[model samples]
Target: MGLIISIIIGLIAGAVAHRVLNSRGGFLGNLVVGLIGALIGGKLAEMFRLQVTGGILDQLVLATVGAILFLFLWRKIRN
Candidate 1:
């Protein structure tokens, strides 16, 4: 149940991040990015011992941060 919620939040966050980052991609692309972002964010949060309350907003915040970071690195690598 938590995982499902997290994934849903990740999808929304990824889509929004794609737009904010001016990323050109389709729905699946956005979903993939967002899912990866969620993993990345979750790992970082764990490492830092950041206590996320396991809610939609928390998931979105974490996913957005991760997505932004991913996009930044992606652009750098592409360039």
Candidate 2:
């Protein structure tokens, strides 16, 4: 159940990030980005001591922001 939820969040977050950044990574790529972003987002939230409400919407926002950051950094490094 937890894994399923994570996957759904990841897909949504990744899609949102891709849309915001105007990137064309496909479904699997977005999933990968989103999953990794979740990890990064979790760590960042911890580091910053951000308040989390334990809601799906909060998780989605965090994951989407992290995915955008990840994509931005990835592009910088790639270029």
Candidate 3:
């Protein structure tokens, strides 16, 4: 289902972002972050009129970028 696919995408993207950012929070937190990032990324893409025909790969890229941005903002806000 679509829901399952989205969760899988989010989890993978979150785990990668976690390692890349070297930030705190465990797997579950990361998963939550990732799902949020996917939503953010979708909005951003829509705003910019950017469309990717490449399915999950494109979703992963956008979600990862969004996750990193979200984490960066979170750090700044926390600090």
Q: Highest TM-score: give the candidate number.
A: 2
- For candidate 1, write residues 42-63 as lDDT tens digits: 9989999998997778888888
Candidate 3 RMSD to the correct structure: 1.3
Give per-residue CA lDDT, model 3, range 1-79, as digits (tens). Answer: 9889889888887887788899776779878989988988888898999977759999999898888888888889999
- Stretches of candidate 1 off by over 4 Å are 1-4
TM-score of every model versus the real structure: 0.83, 0.95, 0.90
The digit string of per-residue lDDT tens for model 2 on 11-67 reads 999999999999998889889999988888988999999999878988888899899
Question: Per-prediction RMSD in angstroms?
Answer: 1.7, 0.7, 1.3
| Model 1, CA-based lDDT | 0.83
Where is model 1 poorest over a 10-residue stretch in terms of lDDT?
A: 2-11
Clashing pairs in model 3, backbone N/Cα/C closer than 3 A: none
* Cα lDDT, all candidates: 0.83, 0.91, 0.85
Superior candidate under TM-score, 2 versus 3: 2
Q: Backbone clash tally for model 3? A: 0
Q: How much is 13 displaced in model 3, in angstroms?
A: 1.0
Q: Which residue pairs collide, candidate 2? A: none
Sorted by TM-score, highest first, which candidate order results? 2, 3, 1
